[model samples]
Target chain A: MDNQRNERKNLRRQRRIELGTQKRSPLGWTILWLIMVVFTIWTMFPIFWAVITSFKHTGDAFNPTFIPWVQFKPTLQGWHFVFITAGERTLRSLKNSILIASCSSALVLLLGAFAGYSLGRFVFRGWKNKDIAVWILSNRMFPPVAVVIPYFLFMRTLRLLDNPLAIIMAHTVLNLPLGVWLMMDFFRDLPRDLEDAAFIDGCSHLGAFFRIALPLAAPGLVAVYVLSFIFSWNEFIFVLVLGFHKATTIPILIAGALTSKGLEFWKVASISLIGIIPVVILTTFVSKFLVRGLTFGALKE
Target chain B: MKYAYRKHVIKWFFLLPCLAYLIVMAIFPLTWSLRLSFTKWLATIMENPEWTGITNFRDILFKDPRFWSALWFTVRFVFLTVVIQLGIGLGLAHLLHNNFRGRNFFRVLFLIPMACPPIAVAFLWKMMLHPDIGIINTALQTIGLAKVKWTTSVVVAPFTIVMVDVWEWTPFMFLVLFAAFQALPVEIYDAAAVDGASNFQVFRKITFPLVAPIIVTIVLIRIIDAFKLFELIFGITSAGPANATEALSFYVYLTGIKWMNLGKGSAMSWIFLLIVLGISLILLSRLRKKI
Candidate 1:
């Protein structure tokens, strides 16, 4: 009985020691929480500044105080400039951005889905599967500088400068590769049994792809489309170089605000806030897919 | 059997549009640029390029200090910003890995900056860092510190650009590392814990080695992307204060578009392309070998 009590006492002391080491100091926990709070503040500060500055008048914009509503009354003049005075140009840019982003993304999706389905599902005679996919991705890996001059001269030769179609075509060059990489992984995940079953039931291969496989990959399709749209929407140099007055995207418009004499921070802020809202909202939905797509499907959750 | 043969023929049609588009847009331009880099036609002087046989490449390689300076600036920017971003991102990922209230909210908040428009980021930062009336300077003076010339001083401008890059892209590293942290094998960590490993010991021995591959992948991709830093510099300083922040891509833009030096610009671009391709090929080959 005495030996048993001694054994129990030793076990109790070991548990106490483990608890002592594992129990984190409250001060350390507080410091970590404080760091995360500071990080969040850092992340949100510029965005918050842009939003508030958009609501401020030209005078209030330079108030230098963090408080927006309390320092002075907020004005809608910046919004008025964006919506009414500069309305035509701003709306045209917005419409152009929407059109270009949507069209390029759609074209990329259609063409990429076809290629991705083929790559993921079939074995071509001459080309290896991995080589073809890597070649497609390598096209994306090339620096945009290599193509800008030639594209400019080529577009000039074709008389397609300042055309929305021209920018759409330019954007497709970037988005299509991304589309193929993304959809290849997505379609590859799907069970081959479904398509084989459909084929055995007398459906054509293409019909089976459309009727059986496409519907199953609908969510992936949406993810790819949204991601490509965000990319095209955020793309700057292509639209800047390829399109001028008629095909100016929102990024170009925001950039134009910077070059004008006596920079209007409030006006720039308003346009910028509007420009980012769509992309920011869209990205949150597909955050998981964004990481997957950006890493070229090498990393997945 | 006939239908199967026909199916094979139809399958080729699916890849044609994308392949053709890439050929016309990507391949043709690349070859054309390769040809252009060998010529000496200024856009304003001549209607057609005059084939001058490696003269453009020679000037860019040996004579042009501007090209070298811009390339150096790009390299330094990529190195500093990526290192800082990895450090911060890893820390944030570790801190948030713990289960806690409001963790998801913080993750969403952290990701907001990554999605903001680059142009907007530039303009907002430009206004916020304006020396005389900027909020940052105001706050500094309020605390009895001297004002900082954030983007104005030549010595500080490049670093300022790096700061913006870190702010904008650190979340990308965070999200990636966070995802990687989640996907780690739980059993190994549990076994390590049961083995009485200290937290640092567990991380150093088990976590770091496994996570190193993804870290390397992030570094490789970030280096490639950061080498093409144009929009931020274009919007923020426009490579201002005597071209202190002229990254190679922006240099190419100024040469080709602003100055209309298409021949030389094309030359610089090809040289830059070869460098990028070389580096990427090396990294990719190493990655393949490892896998």
Candidate 2:
């Protein structure tokens, strides 16, 4: 143990020496800081712009003011307008957005989790699993524009237009392929031993999956869940085409803010802020796992 | 009996609904569009659908200059956005790779743009990019430069879309590549260090080759998404300034929804579908080999 400790100490020292090349010069760090500062400013500018614009009065909104009080006084008018003036409509749309996004994402997640498990764990005789997964992923690439017109007509025919159910159904199709693809990769990456071990302990197949596999795949599930939710929350064309009056979402409302009289920047900014906030929160929380989810667990870091 | 039940019953039970839903929602519409493509069916006209076989496809393929231009513009948009996004994203990933304070915070911040709804992002940028009163031109004036027409000028309007697209999507490339960067084998770097490889050499020989696969996948994904560029166009330019920025999907939206020419729109969409399908096939095959 003493020798091992001494060897480790020596190895760490040697590592430090060799890692000297990895060290950036003072000039390098200054350049890095400059780049990072610029990048950060660039990344934050639009959000900052929106936040500030959202607070400004309609007259003050067009001006290039960077501050709340210094450049121009801020007001609650935009927020008030968002929550009160358009209160009934805004609140309804907000509720619709939440309900559609949550309900559809949950449905997609449940079906995806089950299908992903089967694809990840089970072998079928009739077709290749690879082919099925590839097919499912191919669906993710299907453009919404191609289907929107038909869905519009189809929903209108069924009197499903302006219904949350229609939007939910559309969003389910929009996100299911992604969810199943991500979850399949998740389940496939998981070791089979836990479930097998559960089985040996007399746990039923369903029990093993519920108690063991599901718990283990939680991180991947969370990643896909947030992703599906984000996509559904942000979906525009479906909500725009299929449901507008009764089932208006934040995107449709944002589009509505593009009034024929010309865009009222203050109003647009406020609504955009509402649309952005949930996704911002979701992305921040699940960002680490989201990278894996994006590539369908291809890079396992 | 138990084994068979678990295998067949469970597998089908798990799989069928996903496939079935996709069929109802995606395949059904797609096939309906395919049928619509071969006919002359204007949604505005109240008539039995006229089955005009191959005319829509032939016109879109051979006659319509607008279709060609939209496809061309979309192709340019995809190429430029994907390439620029990859370079900046990979650079950002590499720069952010080293341990630092507030690293995660910055990562999340960078990712915020990509997460913002594309329509909202476009609206925010549109407000900023206004030529006369927008903040972007406002900034240029403050910086002692002449104001530029960000959206109204025919020449610059298309690039305005590209710039906003890069702003909104470069984070996606950054996130995926940064994750790939994190997953790079440290031992190889250490070995390269021991062998006295230069930083450039290490990046070129080790890092580039290692993350090449991810770069491919992410770029392909970005290209696929970019091909469906409607929200940004719809929100910002609406294919304005002589239709210089009219993307394929936007053109399809115009053809199908705006004009109510369902047949021609559906045909154009099928062509668009084939192009995307081709790319996705390649992407999936590459992805299949990786996983």
Clash pairs, candidate 1, are none
Question: Worst lDDT window (10 residues) for model 2 chain B?
Answer: B95-104
Reference A-B contact fraction recovered by candidate 1: 0.51
Clashing pairs in 2: none
Instruction: Mark the regions of model 1 whose C-alpha exceeds 4 Å error after superposition.
Output: A1-22, B1-7, B286-291
lDDT of 2 by residue, B1-83 (tens): 78667668878887999999888888898899899999998878846568999999999999999999999999999999989
Expressed as tens digits, the lDDT of each residue in A180-200 for candidate 2 is 878888898899998888877
- Interface RMSD, prediction 1: 4.1
Sort candidate 1 into its docking category: medium
DockQ of each: 0.50, 0.65
Q: Which regions of candidate 2 fall more than 4 Å away from where they truly are?
A: A1-22, A191-194, A197-204, A296-301, B99-101
